[model samples]
Each structure stands twice: as structure tokens, then as C-alpha cells.
Target: MTKEAGRGHALLVGAGILCSRLFGLVRQRVFSHYFGLSDAADIFSAALRVPNFLQNLFGEGVLSASFIPVYARLLAQHKQEEADRLAGAIAAALALIIAVIVALGVLATPYLLWAIAPGYTGEKRELTILIVRILFPGTGILVWSAWCLGILNSHHKFFLSYVAPVVWNLSMILTMLFFRHRDADRLIVYLAWGTVLGCLLQFLVQLGPVLKLVPGMRLKLDLHSLHVRQVGGSFLGVAIGRGVVQISAFIDQAIATLLGSGAIAGMTTASSINLLPVSLFGMAISASELPTLSRMAGDEWSADVATKLSARLNHGLERIAFFIVPSSMAFFALGNVVVAALYQSGAFTRKDSYYVWAILAGSGVGLLASTFGRLYASTYYAMRDTRTPLRFAIVRLVFTVALGLASALLLPRALDIPLQWGAVGLTASAGVAGWIEFHLLRRKLNKRIGATGVSVAMMVKLWSAAGLAVLVACMVEHYLPLYGPIVTAIFVLSTYGMVYFGVTYLMRIKVCVEVLGKMMRRIGIGG
Candidate 1:
């Protein structure tokens, strides 16, 4: 693809992702307003956890990481037959695996609920079991959707792929609104079914273009293909890594369950809020860059691949820093107002906002680190070096376990802090783990591709902009009542953005220049 095409693709994806994230924030507001850190919300969030965890482990996390690179390589080499065969084989295997897992989840709902949230013994546990069963089949739908998306991405049909999540979010919002008045607890079950429905739609939407690109695309079971084996190994590694990450969350939820009825819900809501920026900017860039990196790798253009990958990485980091840093600072400075504006209606109370904001602030510290880690980890995958990331992921998992244990056994007494801060420890652990992973990936890339593959100067400028934005945001927060939380949020965001852009441009940051140049060309204002 030409640079123009790449920039267009990234813009389309970035814009779509921002829309999806906006809808997601609205969904969270709905949840917060109706549930308000209650037992019902806690049970619902906990129940959704297992299915969502499995979806990530088997569907998005493993399948996309494993399938995209190999599929891209096969398409590049004109091995369409092999790519189709491999896709069919993997899809068939995933079908069987998802089926068995769903069955097991249904049968073991009692035991699974017990192991994950042992503190819930009465109605909460029963409701959780029912909700988990309702959501379990969503894993199957999502797995199929991931396979379809992998095919579409490999074919460089990215627009619809980016739009699919918006569809999913919109459907869930509609479902929640439809059922909000009738037993809000039961609405979660409806949301789960909506998830399945959304996945089906997402999969079918991408199928037309994929079939056009790979004329021989078929749904068949062929387990003996050699290419399937290669994809399978990468898939297994990714599954392990993703499973470890999920385990960390599981541990936190279990610990929170023991603390209080609303603890799990509070932490989950805060986490969902924190993940918004990460998904919009970090994951969007990683997804957009993967195909390009795979094509570069397939062509044996290591120098060009390294340069392009580093440029994209630096750009992603700067963009994320530009937005996330100020957002984080604003959340910390105006935690209550932000929460009140978004989620203070219905059952949500001032107390609940305070607790949730505390969790959000803790999560914000880790958010940037984790986002950067995702960008760096993709570099390793683009180089076809999954083993190194796997090793780093294992070490990160160890840190999670150690930190979880510390939080469970020693943290409460040693710090004299309340139990609600349990998630705080988990977030800190993840932040530390992300920092380690970034440094390791950076060192490895430097060794393999030389020092130029890392962009130190651009990062310095990004950090400078972030620091200035924070200072400006703090001043705005102090001086402005703005009369409303939404208005204040807008003021803070717009002010930070203007200052950040103006300063970065004055400093002549190359990435800013490139982004502005692209914008100018798009507007037919400059060549």
C-alpha cells in the first residue's frame, strides 16, 4: 500500500474506533446510572467476565495475532489455496473448541462461579450462574467473528472491519435501553444475547468482501494442513499469554468479591472506563499497523519494515500521549464532576462516584504503560518473534501473581488501606509489568534492527507536549467551574488539545508535521 492509502486506512480506523468508544462510554454511563455499584451490577459484571475472558483468549487475542501474519504472508506469496485451507482448518478447530468450552461453562456454572467469586453464596451466586450461562455462548459467536475479521484484515479490507465494533456497541446500547425498566438485573442477560447477535452480524458483514478476495473461501474441516500447525503454535502461545492476563483480572475480581458486594462492579466499571482510550488509540494503531508490517516482512524488507514500524510506533505513542495524558490528569483533578456528569443519574450516588473515581485514577497510571506495551509487543509479532513476547508475558504474569498475593495477604494490614483499593494494587502491578515489557521489547528491537529503529527524539517531544498539557489542564480545572461536568470536560479537552498542537508544531515535531501535512492534503489545501 502507498503512504496515502496507509494514512487513509489509519484515519478511517481511528475515527471508527473513536465512535465505538464513545458509544461504549454511553453504555457505561447507562450501567452506572441504573446499577450504581449494587449487588446486581456486581454479579452481572462478574458473570460477563468469564465469557469475555474466554472470548479474548480464544477469539480476538489468539486468533488475530496468529492468523493475520501468516495469512498476509500466504496472500503475498500468491498461495491463496494454502491460505484458504488454513483459514478453514483453523475455523473448524475453533468451532469445536468453542462448542466444548461453552458446554463446559454451562455445566460447570456452579463450580466456576464458586471459584471465581466464592463470597457470593445466596441470590447473588444464583443470579451470577444464570447470567454466565446466558453469556457463555457469546464466546462462540465472537470466535467466528474474529476468524472472519482476520480474513478481511489479511485482504486489506479494513474499513468494514473497523466499523463492526460500532455496530456491536450500538446494538448493546439499544438492548440496554429496551430492557432498562424491567428488572435491570435481567437486562444484563439481554445484553449478553445482544452480544451474540452483534457478533453474528459483524461476521456476516465482512464475509462478502472476504469471499471476493479469496474466491475459494469455504467452511470445512481439514486438520492435517501443515500451515494450520504453524498457525496453531502461535495461537497457543497467544492463548497462554492472554489467559495469564485474564487470570490477573480474575484474581482481582475474586478478591474484590470477598471485600464487599459492590467492589467487583466498581472495579469493573473503572476498568471499562480506563480501557476506552487504550482501545481507541493503542489497539487501533496496532491493528492498523499489523498488515503493513506483515507485508513488509513477507517482502524481506527488514530495513524498510523496521523504519516503517518505528515511525508508526512513535506516531501511535505520541498520539496516545497527546490525548491520554491530559484525560488522565483531568480525571484525577475533576474525578467527581466527571463521574457525576456521565453516571450520576438514577441509582448512582456521590459515594459511588468517589470510589469509582479512585479506581479510575489508579487505573490511569497504568493505562499509558499498557498502551505502549501493546504497540511494542506488536513489533515483535511483526518480526515473527512470538517467543520473546511470550517470555515477557510470562514474567508479567508472575508479577501479577505476586502482586495479587501481596494484595490479598499483606496489603490490607501493612498499608491500613481499605479493601476497595485492592484493584489499585493490581493496576500498579500491571503498570510495572508494562514498563518492563516495553524496555525488553525496545532492547530486543535495538539488537535486531539497530538503534535507529527506536525514535527517542519524537518520544521526547511527545512527553514535552504531555507535560505542558497536564499543566494547562490543571490550571483550567482550578479556574473554571464551567457550571456543568460535560461543559467543563469539553473545556479541559479543547484547551489541552490546542495548547498541545500549538506547542508541538512550534517545536517542529516530525510526526505532527506529517499528520498536519496529511490533513492538509485531505482538505485539498496543500500538497
Candidate 2:
């Protein structure tokens, strides 16, 4: 794709992602109001861990990454018949697998909940199992929907896939609003059903355009196809990598469960907030750039491929550092106020805010690394070399688990840090892993693209500008009263954004200028 087209696609995806994230915040606010950081909320959130872990392992982790590129190749070769057959066979196999998994999940809900969150014993554990059983089916629906999304993405139909998450969030918000007061458990049930409904809607949203692109798209059961085998093999490694990541989460939660009642909820809530910016930039960039990268690889445009890949990677990293570094500083400075304003309305309290802030602080530190990791992983996948990332991912998992366990055992009493603080150690481990992965990926890209064309000086300027922006933001936050939490957060964010952009412009960073120029053009203000 041309640079302009790529930017346009990224913009659209970014806009859709922003919408989904905003609605998701609204949903979280509603949940906080109804349940606070109470045991009920913790149970509901904890119950989701196993199911979501499975979805990540199969859906986003393996299936989308492995399947989309191949599907794109088939479509590009004008092999619609073969492509449709592959999709059908994959869909049928996924369906059977999902059904079996769901059955197991439902049956094993009790043991799963105990294994993940052993801190809960009587009522909390029972309620968690109940919620897990209800929500377990969502995994299967989302897996099928992910396949459809991959199909849409391969066709460059990016808008619907981006918009689908917004629909899901909206559905959950409506459920929460209607059922929150009637029965707390009613809200949980509605949320579970809403998830399944949302996945179906998400799939349907993509299916319309996909059918138009590939006529005669039918659902058939053909496990013997060669295309199916290729997808299966590619997905196997991806699944293992994803499974390891999930195991890390399980370990994190298991440690939290052993810590205290509010530990799991606090960590989950904080992590969600941290993920907002990461998902907005990191995932969006990776998703938007993947097809282009894959196409370049397919066509064997080695030099062009490397140039574009480096440009995109640098742009993504600069964006992440620019936004996340200052955001993390601000989060640590104003976390309590931010949490209180957004979540302290109903069941949530000042104490809950305190716990959540601690988690958010740690997550903030990891935000840039997490965002960078997403882009790094995408680059490796685009090159069709999943094994390298998988190897790194294994090391990451081991580091995360070791740090989490050690922190839990040693840090709480010695440092007077609570058990919830284990998340901090986990985040630091992830950040280390991200740095390692980033360097490795960079070395690999350099080897392929040659050393002469690299742009080290530009990145240095970008990082310098980011540092200056953050310094200004810290000063502003310190001097300004900003009245309430809501006002303070808004003012701090606005000031930080303006200062960051202004400094980047003064530095004349190319990526910043390019992004700003696009924004100006979109607003009809550019020449």
C-alpha cells in the first residue's frame, strides 16, 4: 500500500479502536459503581481469566496471525475456490474444538477457579464457578468470530473488525445499566450472554463484506485439505506461545488470590487501564501494518519491505514512548484522583481507589514495553518466522513466573508492600522481556535490510523530545490545582499532549510531522 493509503487505514482503525476503548471505560465505570472492588466484582473478573486466556491462545494469538496471511496469499492468487474451502474446513475444525473446550471448561469451572484464585474459599469461590460456567461459552463464540475477522482483515476490510469491539462493549454497558440493581448476579449473567451475542454480531458485521469479496463462501467440513494442514501447523506454534502467556496470567492471578480478597480485582482493574493506550497504538499499528508487510514478503520486495518495516516499527515505538512515558509519570502522580473520579460513585470506595492506583502505577511502567512488544511480535509474524518470537516468548514467560513467585514470597513482608504488589514485579519482567525482544527483532531486521539505511539519529531526537515533554507535564501537574480529579486529569492530559506535539514539531521529527500533516489534511487545514 502507498504511504497515504496506509495512514488512512491506520487512522480509521485508530478511530474505531478509540471508540471501543472509550466505551470499554464506560463499561468498567458501570461495573465499579455496581460492584466496586468488592469480592463479587473480583469473582466475576477472575472467572473470566480462564476463558479469556483460552480465547487469546486460540483466537488472537494463533488463528488470526497464522491464518490471515495465508488467506491473503490465496486471495491474491485468485484461488477463491481453494480459499473458501480452507475457511470452511478451518471453521468446522475450530467449531468442534471449541465445543469440546467449552464442555470441559464448564465441567472444570470449580477446579479452574480454585487453581487460579485460591484465596477465595466459600461464597466467592462458588460465585466465581457459577460465573465461569456462564461465561465459558463466550470463548467458543469469540473463536469463531476471530476467524471471520481474520478473513475480513485479509481483504483489507478493516473498519468492521475495528467497530465490532465497540458493539460488544456497548452491549455489556446496556446489560450492566439494566440489571445492576435488580440482581448483581443478573448483571453477570447478562454480561455473559452479551458476550456471546456480541461475538455473533461481530462475525455478521464482517461476513457481509467478506461474502461480497469472495462469492460462494460456504461452510463445509473438509479436514483433509492441504490448506487446512498448513493453517493447523502454523497455528500450533502460535497456540503454544499464547498458551505460555496465558499461563503467566494464571500464575499472576493465582499469586494474587493467595494474597488477599481485593488483590485480584485491583490488579485486573489497573491492568485494564494500562492496556487502553497500548491497545490503541500498539495493536492498531500491528494490525494495520500486517497485510502490507505480508504482501511485501509475498512479492519478495526485500529492500522496500525492510525500509517500510523499519519506518513503521520506528514510528510505532516513538509513538508508544512519546505517549506512554509521560502517561506513566502522570498516572503515578495522579492515580488516586483519576481512579476516584471514574470509579468511586457507587460500590467503589476511596480504599478501592488506593489499591487500584497501586496496580495502575505498576502497569504504567510496563505500558511502553507492552506496546513495543506488540509491534515487535507483528514484525516477526509478518516475516512468517513465528519460531523466533515463540522462543523469546518462552523466556518471557519463565521470567514473568519467576519474578511473580519471588516477589510474592519475599517482597510483601520485607518491603512492607502488599501482595497485590506482585503485579509490579510481573510488569517489570514483561518490560525486560520486551526490551530483549525489541533488540533481537531489530538485529534480525538489520541483517535483512542492511545497516546503511537505518535511522538512529531520528529515533534519538524523538526520544529527547518525549523526555522534554514529560518534564513539562510534571511541572504543570505540580503547579496547577485543576480543582477535582476529573478536571485535573483532563487538564494534565491536554497539557501533556500539546507540549509533546509542540516539542516534536520544534525538533522536526519526520514521523511526528507526517502524522501531524495527515491530521491537518483530515481536518482540511493542510495545504
Candidate 3:
């Protein structure tokens, strides 16, 4: 593909993901309005994580790594029949496995809660168990939704698949909106049911598109195909790697359980904001690049594969840094404004916003690393080398566990600080671990692909632009009279974005120029 096409694909994915993420934020805002940092909020957050464990293990990251390369290769080779069979077999197999797991998970909710939220006792513990059971089956359905995503993404139908989650978020938002008057405990249970319905809606919305794309698809577990076996083989390594990453998240949540009532909920809220850029820029670019990268891996590019791969990889890295640098800075420098804008209302207080901002600030420590790391990992997956990422993920888990324990459990007491501040520690320590894993992945990939990454000068330029943007945004925030959070965010963030892009445009950055050109064309101001 040409450079222009690649950027266009990334933009489509970003636009779709942005829509889904916006609705998700809206969902969270509604939830925060009703639930805030109450014990009920903690219970709902913890319960949600239990079932999401299954989704994460079986969902986008795992499927993209294991299935997309093989399936996309078949499509590239014009072997549509084989690709259809592979997709059918994998979907059927996943459905069967997830069914059994969801059943077992429902039965094991009491036991699972022991690890996920050991600090909860009596009513809190019982309520979490009930909600976890309520949520498990829905997550199973969402795993099927992810299967649809793999198919849609491989077919280059990027927008609908990414935007499908808007329905899910809308479902929950509507549920909360309808039942806003209920007590927190009852409302949360209703929200869980809404989530289940939303999950089903999310799956159905994507299924029609997937079916049209794969008209020859037949659902059966035909494990005999070589491509099928290859995907399964790759799946194991990627699953383990994804599981390692999820384990770090679970461990952090588990530790948060001990930090008092609001820590888990606060971290979840902060994470929602922290993940926006990761999904919008990092995931968007990486997801769009995967199939293209896989297609490039074929015999057509046998000669000069290294040259092409290195060029594409470096370009991806540069694109990721351009947006991510400012995003990370915003989280560190003006996170409270963001947190307030998105989440502060009703039951959620200004103090709550500050608390979440602290965690977002910690998250900023490795935001760029994590985003860059994702594209690197995607490159590894495109090469069909999954074990390297698995090994590095395990190393990250180790650091996360060790540092997480020290920072979250011990450091607060040592510093004579409130226990809740430990939630910030949890995020910051994880960021450090993310950087470590990033370096390892980049170092190894460089040896194989010949030194692929954003250049030193590009880094200097992006970071300098981001720093100035943050300064301008901060000044605007300080001088502007407090309108409501939303209006304030509009002005402050808009200024920040315009300054960043304007400065980069002045610096002759290619992406800024292209982006501005696209905008001007959309407005009929440019040819």
C-alpha cells in the first residue's frame, strides 16, 4: 500500500475507535453520576473485571495476533475458501470454549472473588459474586463480538467493527438513564443486565457485516487444516502473553482492594481516560497496519522485505509518537481538567477528580512507551513471531508484581501518606514496567528488521511541541473562568490541540501537513 492509503486506513480506524470511546466515556460519566466512589461503585468495577478477564484473553489482542496473519495471508493469496473455513472453525471453537468457561465462571464466582477482591467481606463480597455471575455470560457473548472484529478487520471493514461498541455503551447508558432513580445497589445490578444486553447488541451489529464478507463461512470445528493448526499454535503463545498482561491488571486491582474503598474504582475511572489515546492512536494505527503488514509478508515481497518492513515500522512509530507524546503530556500536566471534564458531576466530586488525576498522572509515565510498544508488538505478530512478545510480557509481569507490591502496599506507609495514594503508585510502577518491556521488544526487533523506530530528532520535535502545547493549555485553564467541565475542556483541549498541530505544521512535520490538508479539503478550503 502507498503511504497515503496507510494513513487513510489509520484515520478510519481512529475515527471509528474515537466514536466507540466517546460513548464509553459517556457510559462511565453516567455511571459516575449515580455511583461515584461508593462501595457499590467498587463492587461494580471489580465485578466487571472478573468477566472481562475472559474477553481480554479471547478478544481483540489475542485474535489479532493469532488469527489475522494467517487468515489475511490466505486472502492475499486468493484462497477465499481456506480463509472462510479457518474463520468458521476458529469462531465455532471459541464459542464452545467460552461457553464452558462462562458456565464454570458462573459457578466459580465465589472462588474468583477471593483472588480479585479478597478485602471485601459479607455484603460487599456477596454482592460482587452476584454481579460477577450476572456479567460472565455477557462477556462470553462479547468474545464472539471480538471474533467478528477479527473477520471485519481482516476484510478491511474497519469502521463498523470499531464503532459497533457504541451500541454496547449506549445500551448501558440508556439503562442507567432509565433507572437513574434506583438506589445504588439495585441500579448496579440493573446496569449489569444492561451490559449483558449491550454485549448481545454489539455482537449482532457486527455479525451481518462479517457474514456478507465471508459468504462461504460454515461453522464447524475443523482442526485438521494446517492454517487452523498454525493459528492455534500461535494462539497459545499470544494468549499467554495477553494473560500475563491481564494478570498484571488483576494484580493491581487486587492490591487496590486493600487500599480502602475507592482505590479500585478510582483506578478504573483513571484507566478509562488513560486508555483513550492508546486505543485511538496506538490501537488504531496498529490494527489497521496488521493486515497490510501480513499481506506484505507474502512471497510478493520476498526481496526487499526487510527494507519495506523497516520503513513501514518506522513510519508507524513516528505516527504513534506524534499524537501520543501530547496525549501523555496532557495526562501528566492537565489530567485534572480532563478527569473533571469527562467524569466530574452528580455524585463525583472535585476531590474525586483530583484523585483520578493522580492516577492518570502516574499513567502518563509510560503512556508513550505503552503506545509505541503496541505497534512494536504488532510488528512481531505480523512476522508471526509470538513467543518473543510472550517472553517480554512475562518479564513485564514480574516487574509489575514486584514494584506494584512495594509501591502500592508498602510505600504509602513508609512515606506516611494516605493509603489511597497507593493507587497512584500502582499506575506509576506499571508504567516503569511498560518502559522496560518496550525496550526489550524494540531491541530484539531492531536486530531482525534493522533499527526501526522514531528518530531522535522526531522525538525532540514531538516532545517540544507537546510541552509548548501543554503550557498553552494550562495557561488557558488558569485564565479562563470556570464554565462547566465540558465547556472548559472544549476550550482548553482545543487550544492544546491547535497549538500542537500548528507548531508541528510550522516545523514542517509531514503528518501535521497531511492532516491539515485533509481538514482543509473537507471544508472546501484546499484542493
For candidate 2, give the lDDT: 0.73
Ranking by lDDT: 3, 1, 2
TM-score of 1: 0.91
What is the alpha-carbon lDDT for the whole of candidate 1?
Answer: 0.74
Tens digits of per-residue lDDT, candidate 2, 272-321, equal 67777777777777787777766766746667767777776665566555
Off by over 4 Å in 2: 183-186, 299-325, 332-338, 448-460, 479-482
What are the Cα lDDT values of the candidates?
0.74, 0.73, 0.92
Candidate 3 colliding pairs: none
Lowest lDDT 10-residue stretch of candidate 2: 450-459
Summed backbone clashes in each candidate are 0, 0, 0
Candidate 1, after superposition: displacement of residue 159 in Å?
2.4
Model 3 — TM-score against the truth?
0.98
Task: In model 1, state the lDDT of residue 453.
Answer: 30
RMSD of each: 2.7, 2.7, 1.2
Please provide the root mean square deviation of candidate 3 (C-alpha atoms, Å). 1.2
| TM-score of every candidate | 0.91, 0.92, 0.98
C-alpha lDDT (0 to 100) for residue 516 of candidate 3: 88
Model number with the top TM-score: 3
For candidate 3, write residues 62-95 as lDDT tens digits: 9998899999999888999989999999988998
What are the clashing pairs of model 1?
none
